[model samples]
Target chain A: MLEELTIQQKIKYLQDTLYVISGKWKLLILMSMYGGTCRFRELQRSVEGITTRVLSKELKELEVNKLIERKIDNTYPVLITYQLTPYSFSLKPMVDEMITWGAQHRKELSKP
Target chain B: MLEELTIQQKIKYLQDTLYVISGKWKLLILMSMYGGTCRFRELQRSVEGITTRVLSKELKELEVNKLIERKIDNTYPVLITYQLTPYSFSLKPMVDEMITWGAQHRKELSKP
Candidate 1:
């Protein structure tokens, strides 16, 4: 049997998962991937405000976590694209809820 | 009118929201509250092994974020309890999804 984590260890494990997806642009990248697989430049355009550096970093982190898969296409010059893994797609509902919640909260903020 | 945040600003704003809820124990606290308003001791028990210090700190932070409300019951001695605010309750679906997702992912982890 796999060892059971202590409460502290379980909490730490949860925290680590949060940390992996904790960046500003990570969810936006996630949201973007919902449309289709995206080339590096396509993601930049889709998210529309992330800098190259932060996007690169967030993509690398997601890739490392196995939430995203990067595929290289060698048709002439190499083209690279990112797509959500099945694991990553599992988070779609959470991300959508966040977006919906954000919209509602934003509406409230506009109240006098 | 509040100025529209730049793309960089928008990303940062989204990230800040994530950071506020990103703690390991935060969702568990939210989950426990679903049962009912939780006395401090009750929360400690429901969560099953969070340090008193960390619980106190997390409670304070949740209060600061306006996601939870703390009430002091003055029945002879003082009793403190935490309850989810409407805003916090709005997160119920998201939290539920996380728990469900975690369970599914855990099952996958156990597969050879």
Candidate 2:
């Protein structure tokens, strides 16, 4: 499929994808939520090194992109949680490939 | 494989990959080389909108990462060309997945 794309189209497609997922924290935040729905504090804890403010912004962006859903439970003490949407699964192949490549890269770099 | 990883390890792996490929221009420069080896001027032209200075920097970084080789032919006019290293092909699976997801993302965003 990539072979079928002209260079211009390929670049545009790559740009679109990167715009949604390229960031220090977006993918990490999403990875954290993969286990189950997570409240804001839980997410902050799970995605270590993420500040509360940064996590809030990343979650909002993910929600706007439809990659995640923010659910609110209106109890005596309101509870809000974030979870991956079905659409987020679209990233699984790419993410898997990245992990495979990354692990290999680490090994390659460690060669004596 | 990803499921087996603790969250910390997963995040580290992801970060390792992103450090190499996450950027506005690195992948674009790489995509241009997929056709074949190219001289600096040719690459700058093919990767539209890239300045000579930026392209030079990107090429040097790619060489440092061992993703590309910069060969200088000490002929009459010094024929310098950049080509992808075998290690770079390891990125093919990830790049293909990105292109696939990227095209789908463009379509998704165009919904009425």
- Model 1, residue B41: what's the lDDT? 86
Native-to-model Cα distance after best TM-score fit, residue A24 in candidate 2, in Å: 1.6
Task: Report per-candidate DockQ.
Answer: 0.19, 0.68
Pairs that clash in candidate 1: none
- Model 2, span B1-112: residue lDDT tens: 6778876776788888988887788999998898989999899888878898988988888887789999989999889999999989989889889888999987776786
Docking class of 1: incorrect
i-RMSD per candidate, Å: 6.4, 1.3
Listing every candidate in turn, what is its Cα RMSD in Å to the true structure after a full C-alpha superposition? 6.7, 1.9
What residue pairs clash in candidate 2, if any at all? none
Off by over 4 Å in 1: A1-20, A35-57, A74-79, A108-112, B1-20, B39-57, B74-78, B108-112
